[model samples]
Target: MTIHSSHPFLPPPEDRDPVRRLRGRLPAPVSVWTSSNGPIRGGWTISSMLVADGDPGELVALVNEDADWWDLFRKTRLACVNVLASRQSRVSEVFARVAPSPGGPFRTGEWVDSAYGPRLADAAAWVGVRLVDADPEHSGWGLLVRARIESVDLAEGRIALQHLGGHYS
Candidate 1:
């Protein structure tokens, strides 16, 4: 007996630079992913989040493995992905700061948590999601996190936040 083998239209490995290819894509909307670690906690605003699955409510967020929030997320397995409004640009900046810096922007505000997740009283709107799964592979640092939507709170206005050129506007 003989078996037949066929190769499909597979791109060469050298031609598949996922990071470079993805970077060329336009910047995505930014959101603050908040997680708690007992007495110590932090949150980072990122634009790399993507909706993984819609039926069971799954998502994928590209968070740096070295990010301060990564460990907290790993431990607690819970977080709030806060979608900011156009007027909340300042809040976005606060969470976008690099780690290991004292007096960073996150220190300048009064932050609180809600049933959905952390809430910036001044933010235009926000939502909470419970982390379900995170898979980090070799893709310039990322985690495929599945979360369940807990709640959504919209401020008394409607505005969309956008990110471009490594900045929020």
Candidate 2:
């Protein structure tokens, strides 16, 4: 007799993970990570990432286990992090799957295939990385991908696109 759109097994907002709630309050930079396996290309908008400095700098990120970009990234073991500028939220929305694309997300913007992966044509800052390790992380329901920084291109400054409180800010 119950008619509703929400999944029965899905937890209510009040019952969700507290850790995730806390993390959501922390503003995270928004960027697009793109990868290609031969001719197959994919990109994803992401805000969960970190950088560790050492002999060889390492980039760490959490990715959805069931995304096209993740598939290409795993196969190629390479990616390019295109830091989205404040004025590029539309690009982010396209890659995030929150906005519709007539042809495809890639068609929304210009890109250049590089040794690392696909670079947003006008990305102010970008990083090329080679996969180092990937581990399963279930708490947030994502894979933890760690990569070594192979190349870095800084044109202007770090991007200002950010995500917080379950919204872009």
Candidate 3:
């Protein structure tokens, strides 16, 4: 499949750049994509997470073609997207680390296995999703997964987090 980029000079329908068009109209929510199992058989993390649909609890996330968590996700077919609170920037930093490994974030941290999946002990809230389908085109990304939410846990706190642009406030 061809993912097009939006052209600024053209009209809405004429715009070919999907990311640019999307950026102009939508504000993406930040989420840490996570999975389980590695050399130590623990958890993992990814940076791309998006809600695919509302009904039937659907969501979409992109995993890099070469990431370790991609393999785990392929096997388990399950994952958790942890939504961090404002005070949880440290958690994001931990997950965002490029060294060590993808599971680096959970190296020394605590987590709980939930009906949805594994959730960070400190996350404000989290949703569990079971892989329904995956489409990996030519983007070199592992695959774009459409998942069904299995369950949700909403913890107490004001939601605030940062993404590609900056902090969400």
For each candidate, give its TM-score against the true structure.
Answer: 0.69, 0.83, 0.66
Clashes of 1: 0
What does the lDDT read for residue 148 in candidate 2? 93
Which candidate has the top score in TM-score?
2
lDDT (Cα, tens digit) per residue for candidate 1, span 1-169: 5554733554676877777556746767768888765556678887777765465555567777767887787777777777777776776767876433357545645578654445665665566676665555545555545576665667686665877644556
**What are the runs in model 1 whose C-alpha is more than 4 Å off?**
1-27, 98-105
Q: State, as a TM-score between 0 and 1, how close model 1 is to the true structure.
A: 0.69
Best candidate according to lDDT: 2
25-144 in candidate 2: lDDT tens per residue? 898888899998778889998888988998699988888888778877877889999987777788999998999989899988788888888898777689999888655465367788
Q: Candidate 2 — what's its lDDT?
A: 0.83
Candidate 3 shows a clash count of: 7
User: Given candidate 1, what's the lDDT at residue 80?
Assistant: 70
Model 3 regions lying over 4 Å from their true place: 1-27, 37-47, 99-103, 138-142, 164-169
Q: List the residue pairs that clash in candidate 1.
A: none
| Residue-level lDDT tens digits of model 3 in 1-169 | 5555854446766655677555545445556667765432324444456665677868766666666566666677778878776666666666555434354566535667654445777776688888785445543344666778877778876564645433343
- Displacement of residue 100 (Cα, Å) in model 2 is 0.7
Give the clashing residue pairs of candidate 2, or none.
none
